[model samples]
Target: MISPRVNTRVWQRSISLLSPQAAKTESNVVTKERTYIENLSKDIATSRFRLVDENGKIASITVQPDIPICIKKDCLVSIHNLNHLSLSYKWLNFWSNLIKFRSFKSSLFHRIIGSSVLEILAAPNFQTSRRPFDSSRSLSVLNLTGTKDWNVFGKDSIIAFEQNSSLEIKSPIFPSARSLVSNSSKSQLPRKFQILNGRGNVLVCGGGLVYSIELIDESDKILVNSRNILAINGQ
Candidate 1:
């Protein structure tokens, strides 16, 4: 005859060994990491310029007509100009851009249509290539604070910028005249670099991936290929 306490202990042990334990579930757990493009969208959600799509191949930018935006004529996809916005063309570096860049697309200019929402898309022809690291073609947005100037490479890559902002086409500054003459023969050197200023947003199209890097100070310098560079802070 087993004692009552012994039987209770045996039963408890058997139950503990037979039953499965409940898993602790967390309600606040994040299963996936958000992409950088999503983060970029959030940062400028309140601004007039919004990044609609930037999925490595095709990139799109949506613009609200609070202010006029200058866009490349070729990149214009659609516009809502029921009566609010207006469209016009202006010559920007027409002859120089045509000769230097060997492309007539950048020579022509198109302005935002009246009181309209604009959609601009850029789909580089080589986007389908099987290159492992092809971040050269993509789209990026720059939020200008009216403080420092910015230098934009490949004027053709410039899809649009706020009309209130100022863009000046200038030649690249060399350390000295000798360096400029020596590199004149180099086909890789950009014939012109567009200097951007004022407070607004700039939409730039790159060859592959569009990303940003911050240099904390003068000590935090980085070397990147000129061809791959889209924009740089003039400071």
Candidate 2:
């Protein structure tokens, strides 16, 4: 299969954060109502998927059978041709307004939200958009068939990824800040880097252009910030 090409606009000098008014207008936040899965897939060619573009154009990619992708449950537009898809709770936040998991690894202490499935009339496109950042970069899907691992990304960086995968948190977050905070403070918060393991595909929006750096082995670790990451597989 051919690799998909995504169109990118030149980077802006400064980006504006979402305004309260704009946040209020989004249907994703205002409504908990979901579209029928069968209905979403039924007319997927021209209907169902909604991009962040003002023109309402939709982009789509196909997922091979049993290949589970990770996505913010809210960003999911539609999925088709597969059954037996499962959901595992990733994490929850009482501190921030943004809750980051539609599918996340289980943690014992987080608050659990009740679940429901979003589907449409037909096959659905796994659609997503940039949030709390560059909201215009509508959708970007990376096929993991040829690659082994990906970079660690911000919590919001992923829209959807392969379900078979797992994520691990890395340590010693930043060099300069290591001395700034006490070791006890470090234990209180979440770890710095998250490693994604397992197989199948991962779909991500890196906010601007998405780049993949191929690593040949375990010792080849890339020292980078977590926010800049998209996804990674293997140790």
Candidate 3:
């Protein structure tokens, strides 16, 4: 018996977000017009399970801390709107979007939009930040408010916004994305810092703010209370 690498995966990710619900066109299984919706609002905590449909690119979803866990297998999972509904099933591998049981409340940017933002899918890694990661830094993580509401992300993942929300990444290139991943809690204060994985090609504003993102593989993720962030160096 062997084990997989810490953050490594064994399959190609079919996609980032969950797939659309399609009705079973065959007679071998139950058939129904699948409706989409967000079943819960709190946090999600569960175990790791695999799905056959999604090619294993970044599969393997784990819900350790249960704040807004979904119903057991074969149950109705209710969400606020159909659009918020992303992942659903008795088992899932990668949590492309917000679909966990554990949730940490954040009022800092709440009510500013249609809904409160949750978890944050951290952008590429940046050098240790140069600006003070506090209330001022909070504005950095607020991606554009287009058709994509920021509250959905807020509910699923925690932005590096809280103070002390730092972690030791596997490479120096990662921590460099600090400014891009900044939050009131965790941030790389050194404006002199550099951007690691520059597929994003991001730059810090005079006030330490950014208005764009390139998007890349920001996979190996974590969410500790910003206050728990200690020092981040070569891990």
The candidate scoring highest on lDDT is: 1
| Model 2 regions lying over 4 Å from their true place | 1-70, 79-134, 143-148, 165-191, 211-235
lDDT of 3 by residue, 1-235 (tens): 3356543352342222212122133221111101110111122221222221221111112222221222212111122332232343322112311123222121111110112222322221112233222312211212111112121122212322211112110112122333326345454433222112201111111222222221224543444343322122222
Measured against the true structure, the TM-scores of the candidates, in listed sequence, are 0.59, 0.35, 0.15
C-alpha lDDT values of all predictions? 0.53, 0.35, 0.22
Rank by TM-score, descending?
1, 2, 3
Task: Identify the leading candidate in terms of TM-score.
Answer: 1
Between candidates 2 and 3, name the one with more favorable TM-score.
2
Which wins on TM-score, candidate 1 or candidate 2?
1
lDDT of 1 by residue, 76-183 (tens): 545544466677886666666676677777756677644556554544433234552244555566666555777777757676665652434343333122211223
Deviation of model 1 at 190, angstroms:
4.4
Which whole-number lDDT from 0 to 100 does residue 81 have in model 1? 43
Candidate 2: tens digits of C-alpha lDDT, residues 142-205: 3333224444445554444434333322222241221113335432122333344433333445
Q: What is the lDDT of residue 23 in candidate 2?
A: 36
Q: Candidate 1 at 100: error in angstroms?
A: 2.9
- Residue 83's C-alpha lDDT in candidate 1? 66
Candidate 2 at 50: error in angstroms?
A: 15
